[model samples]
Target: MDRKSLSLLILIVLLGLCIRLQNFGEIFDSRIYYYGYDPYYHMRLVEAIVLEGYRPSFDYYINYPYGLRIDWLPLFDYILAFPGLFLGFWASEIFAVVFPVIIGVLCIVLVYLISLEVLRNEKFALISAFIFSVCPVTVWKSLLGKADHHIWVVFLLLLSIWLVTKPGLLKLLSGIPMLLMALSWLGAPIYAALLAVSSLFQFNEKEVRIVGISNLIPVLSSIQNLFLGFSFLAIAVFLLVGSFVKRFERRFRYAIVYYLCICSVALLSAYLMPVGWLGFVKSGISYVLGTDIYLPTIREARSFQILGVISSAGYLFFVLAIPALFMLRNGFLKVFFVLSFLISILQLRFVEVLAFPVAILASYTICQILERVDYPVFRKEEEGESKRRGRKEKKKAVEIRKKDHATVIAFLLFLALPCFANSLAPVEMTMDWKEALNWMKENLEAQDYLKAYEKPDYAVLSWWDYGNWILYVAKKAVVCNNFQAGADDAAKFFTAQSEEEAMKIVEKRKVRYVVTVEELTVKPETNKTKFIPIMQIAGYSPEYMKNKEIIDFFNKTMLYKLHVENATNLTHFRLLKNFGTVKIFEVK
Candidate 1:
């Protein structure tokens, strides 16, 4: 609460802002350019909401002729859309680009507050905030132009945790953030599960009630259909009975019973309505655990290696974080850290959540080590004798302590340098891809492509990676996109053994254009090729690319003919544009 502490916290937040904004110039040429696949789709949705005043429940642009129901939580897109209500579309895009940075900076402040609560030391709290500010795991996802729900997920979850730690009225309102978290990300239920389990370590009635009630809102709202309605009513009755009749003498027993009851409701709902809440939760869990059949094809779903973790978290931070898990005094944080770390090892996307507790625990451990050191700067001056000592001696001690603080701060900054440096790079679509999509948009519009069902006359067929870009930038229909909806068909079309087989898929799906990236056809010198992943997703054996016969077969596929051979001699496909990184072909 002191001025110095407040000043330092402000400085730490500013530091995070600077790091997140480091590549802002590259992302903004004439206008804001988003950094990744999902952001583009979200921005597209935001524009829709801004102009239409509500998100269309079903979007015809994605998943081609079948279309796709918009299942994503509207809260994040709504947040971006609100700006457009006052400032129009372009301004909204600008706001969306910078929104993640604003959330990231706020998260830095929350980290400090939560750390202070758990550690009970302002010094350690400040260190934790500083650590999180530059932590690569968080910085990369929360950078400017990376306007995805992930940053909002981190912020709302952190806010919920910090709220739960408060006393009285503030504690009761904790459920609000948990509700917002649920609405922000489909993965929020898993976090609620973790929090419920953590309660067994340190049970708090208010915290449990807040989490339980907040979790129920999402489940209850999923009652539009008959089966879900019945399931919801049944779960509601069971919860009422349990609340009144289930009286346990022990707090631990109460915690266990409530947690199990919540699980039961989820299981029953999932059983009754496979297409509802449980399905979504299972999909999230499957994606995080890499249990989904197609998850390995997605880059963020890949398991993290030890070296990757170290690189993202920093070598020293990882080293301290592991021990700090045990050294941490707060039971909730201890359990949360272990759960997040274990899951993060399986899926890289979970690393951002893991960063929260890692910063706290690592900073806690650092403070412990520094405090235990024999150096005079860390040692408290003798109290009784200090009263008798001259003012000069006391002032000298203060000066030494100041120097000590500076030394430790310098050392902490040194530990954070690697993560800071790693967070500097920004990922965006190549200019070639951008120009190609722009050209596609202009040509499609010129051809009166939007006459039917408010959709383009034809769908573009591309790998799942470029689906969002094609959807958002080209403003066209797509066979497959970031949602992984039409990926199997895409894989089949691209890897089909013959142009005839590929044409069957294209004709079946009404795909008129095929987009190809060189990475899908050619291997990079230093890295593995996307062709292998495409092959894998299409059900090829792991070593298919290694076999000479299979490689020859792959060379004959529609993807190779289009991207590598320029569709030369191909009968039914015509090359439209070759933009080096991106290629477009029209099905004739």
Candidate 2:
């Protein structure tokens, strides 16, 4: 790398890490990572695997007693295992801050290398990496202690794309990263599917082959028919072909060989492996299908404005990338970009995967703008210095070019300001609510809530939104978590007309505690309650979601008065503790 490029690369990575650490100033400062759904979910899992040695069976933490088995990918969690053991109970907090930032920082380097391979221009690649490094949502999602697996998924995707950009034998060995990518996240399948399909474009290539995946670790998971496992089995068949035919590359269908192999494995898996394989594929796709229209989700269900973390300028390039791919058609990266972009619009979480391509395309657009002004940074090597002298004869054009230099700089800053601005959003907002959870942990007795015969069991009845946090932070059983039925129950609990009705449901679930954020409460004078929109329930549907359903559930039921003075006599509930805006009420 050139001296300037290498220096800028290091600068971008350092800046990315610093921006992500913007929320954190010191280690063990008590507020290291965001304390929300995915973060807490992973934290609880890491704590279980490392500290408790809690191997989940039919009874898992997420869905609670009703038990919806969340398909948890263990790759990132395994990375935290050893360190978590040393930290003991504090494992999640420490690992949360460390892993994401480490992976995110590495992404800066990976993104730069991937861009360099595609663009073959260090200048453009540096800009691409800069855009990615500073992307507001990217920064927030990839921050230290955030503890989401999507970053690993993104890193694997970029590596796979980078492999696609490689020459010959390297590309053939891409199944290695592809295998890792598929095992890492839900979206990895999309990458595999796209890669397989892209190979169709070059089916006629004379030296194509679908080699077997080298399984370094056997007996990975219980489900032998896992999609990731299927990926390997597909590779095994590919390798077996090499023994029979000397070279599968000589065939016209060589490029599509991987596609056929994966398809065959998938079909075989569906018929013989188990119905879960088909169900898994269906469930994964159902998430992004806008038509599915589930009640609440983290991403697409909400309006596009929900993803305000990404600035309008950044989003403009994100839109530009569709055409950008079409412009650079007939490549593996283009296929992946086009597919990822298509899915991204359906969900905001999926947008992080687009950071590489979005940044790459944005960099190209910036370069194009600079090229128009004949800016030195973007200008191709000139044959003569007199070219500027000759061009100077056109005084008007020279003045226009000079005037545009400021425009280029302005535009660069304009595009960058939002990402940095977004990075500044209060990180405290994530874990601030954990105060309620902490209070419960210190107060609640030690035992599982379902075991009523042993001790008076306790369960926290809160909205499904904070269930993960309550369980993770307080080590208490939550009435509802990510499960849809649990969410429905919580919704009913809050909206019920009478305390007796709300308590009936709470008692049925053995919920000793009912938690509510002060923001969700109404102003006693106004008789109005605000909708604390459920974070994950933010859906991509265009169907107008009436906030009134939840807001009036508080107002119409007079539940808002619970936080106000002398609102109503405690018929069936008693105040336990109030942690700032977070309030806990005991079911009387």
Candidate 3:
């Protein structure tokens, strides 16, 4: 209700909006949004689901020879499909642009709530909220169409933390959101683990024993179903351990019972929900064990390093605010802050999650340090004067609080400078292929196929980046894309063979065109034999083989011809179309 708190809330909301709204058009209007192979696949599947009013069979995505069934998590695509059904595809694209911004703002508000409980200072809470709102990685992800699941994961994780720390009638309502969060992404279980741990520490002993007994009943009832039975047993163990640790007592037994009943109801409902629980269980286990996963490569390491440095700087600012942590004097807050900090550092991808906590701790530390400063007026006053000065001090404290509010605002703005810079220069926007995509749209027809020499998903010619655009704009099927984890056909296409062997593939697949860029052709000397140079682009050099016999063959052959003025670079050719950039001909 205070002026400062109201101002801070407005500031956090505005910061979230500004970061999320920037370049929203980039995602909403571009073919690139659809080009990413997974998004493309999801869009197609969602469209089918909407039209058919039924989930597609798993066989639809797993028709390759390998017989691998990829069970994709469906919550995000399903949510997207609903809007698409009402608004149609274009409006749905716009929805993707705005949805994450709304979620990001909610996340900011939740962070403030969590911080206020921990720091007990409105100013410190606002600082934490500001830090989260402007984090570059958070902002960047929120702007993209594909960011729905990631933002939901972060928001739900924070909401769960708030619920565990503050438990009330309202907090119990947090479970609805938690269920949605669990459905949102493969990473949901990690957040669940954190929540369960936090909740375990807060539970009492007698309540735990009752819950443990109740959980065991289900296990005993389903002992014949090994997996299901074991899962129930594990829940029972967790309940017992949690209850014992917190020393559960008779006074709180009813609360514990209510909590267990809610969980049991949730479990029963999950079994009957028709939400592909079995598929989720299988995929979730596979994800945890790191099977069939794609990891960041050396090129991706550069972006990670940038994100890491920015996050670490935010933590440093928080450490500088150490005095506030001590001044707040909340034992639970201290434990949560320390544990969250350690967990954030342990995982590189999670650095953004630490920003809010660090900022709050830092703000609290700063406020406490300011409060303890030795003013000359206090030191010089006599006993009577001290009493008079004490009254004056109360009035002065009000003024100082107002002035320090501005200082906190300024400090947050300083912390957000890095994020602002990053927002303007996203790693994806600066790549050369954005230009290549433009060129292809102008020159190529809907039916022309593109055979890329390099593996596109490697950031050089990332399959995810262009695959959907090719499908949407060019109406072409890519030889391969980033859906490599589950795209067995695409994976096979990449490993198949040289241009001579590719000729057979092209004929069999009825491929009409091949596209090669600088990055794809400039490989190591060892890979040269594996790839025959069909076209030379900006960054290539070809060695000439000269002999009277070879010269005679070149002159006599209809297959070989030069298409460009520059022999060393920028040549395009077709094997059959001798009029174009066709470098060689195959007698079809």
Candidate 4:
């Protein structure tokens, strides 16, 4: 790379870092807390690896009375624990919080490299880097203290793409990132599927062989079921056979053969194992459509709305990204981009995955427009040195060039300002919940505290959203957690109208404490006494909250009594601490 290009890359990296870390103080203050529920669980796993030397096979802190198996991949936690190994637990926790910011910046650099390789233009590559730097969804997900595996998913996927673009054996090494990606997130299958399908269009045998082999590494190591293993194996076998087939002798192209092979395998599987095949297909469809029992209640699993994309990624980039896809020339990239866009539209959980593609496409469009501009005309000069020109002509030429430069700079900034501003969101858990959980940790006599995996004496009951926070922060067991393990009971416990009905669930789950937040009970801003999510999870109709009698009945339920009435009038519950917006109640 030339010095100027290198300097510009460095500047763009710095700008990306600045935008993501602008609220560093708020996120990593004297009392360090993570931004969301999942990060806390991730740090807890890191703590286990750092302190216990390994993650426990079974966790006693969540899904109380039955505990939960620790099935999450440990690679991401191991990466987080690397810093703690050298710096100690406290410093490592801080490092874990800051790790995503570093990865976020690395993603910006990877986008630049991939864009340059695909577009073969330095200017467009740099523009792509800048767009990704300020892309709001990417920035928000990778901000300080927002430590989650989703950012690593993006980074590893981009790194894998860049690696595959290299020549010779270097392309085979793409499997390393693919392997890491499989261990980093559960959605790695989406990427593997995209690559497998896109490779069919490649006329080069070497490209097909390398991508197929790279993908097989993940499947071999991570396979857990017979059906999924068989599915991937069939695809791999076809690719291996296609690698040796002579391109000229075939009546049909390899792409056609590959397509037919997949259809044939799918049909054969459906015929041979009707029940298992139907279940697999149904589950996949339900998850993407958000039509499943649990998924519809989770915020991130809901179907995407265009307004949400505009809100998170900005209207300007979203507008340009549509046409930008058509402008992208790389076949593999176009396939991956289109698939990601479609999946995101099906489920919002994949929305952040659009960051890299949207940024590159939007940048391509912007640069294309800029390249079409007509610069100021000047007299043709000699190649080496121009003859002495009149002072008047020289001054006029200089003025015109300056005006053109200013106009280009102004136009770029105008397009970037809104996106940069949109990327400035900072997320932090409520201080009230933090203090309450801390108080429970210090004052409550909940357990023996002998071991990390030791079961607590009792469990806390709350909506599933806060279960991870209660487990990690309060150092106690919970009836439900982010995994949706005990979601049904949690929903039943909170929505039960009579003390008798609520107590039955509490007894079944051995729950001694319940947590409530303002949004669960009453929030004036939305003009609802209870949030809709709890109702949804409880299987209540949407119209239930509308009727006056139904609303009155809700006012008498266990959740309402705990938060609105302070648990004072309830027979089996007593309010222990009330932090205005957040309240904790002790079950008798």
List ranges where model 4 is wrong by over 4 Å.
Answer: 223-235, 238-286, 289-291, 375-406, 446-452, 522-530, 543-550
Regions of candidate 3 where Cα sits further than 4 Å from its true position:
28-42, 50-70, 144-146, 169-171, 202-237, 248-293, 296-347, 369-398, 401-405, 423-465, 468-475, 486-588
Taking the tens digit of each residue's C-alpha lDDT, what string does model 4 give over 1-588? 799789989989998898877777666554777876799888888888887788776887788888889767778888888888877888778887888999999999999998887766776788789878887888888988877898898888888778777777777777678777767665566666656655555436777787667667666544644334444454566666656553532665454556547665874566456595466444444555677777767766767665666656545776787787687666666666677777777777777767777777887777767655643211233211344532333333333466775786677667778878777764446778878888888877766432556777788888888887887878788899998988889888878878899999999999888889877764433555445666777788756455555566567777788888888888899998888788988888
lDDT of 4: 0.74
Error of 2 at 523 (Å): 7.1
Ranking by TM-score: 4, 1, 2, 3
Error of 2 at 311 (Å): 4.3
Question: What overall lDDT goes with each candidate model?
Answer: 0.74, 0.59, 0.48, 0.74
Candidate topping TM-score: 4
Clashes of each: 0, 12, 20, 0
Estimated TM-score for each candidate = 0.85, 0.78, 0.64, 0.87
lDDT of 3 by residue, 356-457 (tens): 555566666655544455311223323357677564443343234555556655755775666577655343432344444554446544332221111122
Error of 3 at 434 (Å): 6.1
RMSD over all Cα atoms, model 2 = 6.4
> How many Å off is the CA of 108 in candidate 1?
0.2
Better of 2 and 3 by lDDT: 2
Candidate 1 stretches greater than 4 Å from native: 204-288, 304-307, 374-403, 445-453, 524-527, 543-553
Candidate 2 lDDT over 1-588, as tens digits, reads: 988678878988888888877656532455443533667666666666775575343333434445555566656666666676666656555766777788888888887888777667787788788888887667766776677777777777676666656666676556666556555554555555555444444323322343223221211332522655654454445434433433344564453446456665765555454576466555555655544433334333443543442452255556545556645534655655665556665555566766776788777767766666566443443424547557433333333455564676567667777566756645334344756666687886655532212223456787776777777667777767744446656656665667677666776677777777765564435533333333223321212535544444446552464554323465767777766677778766
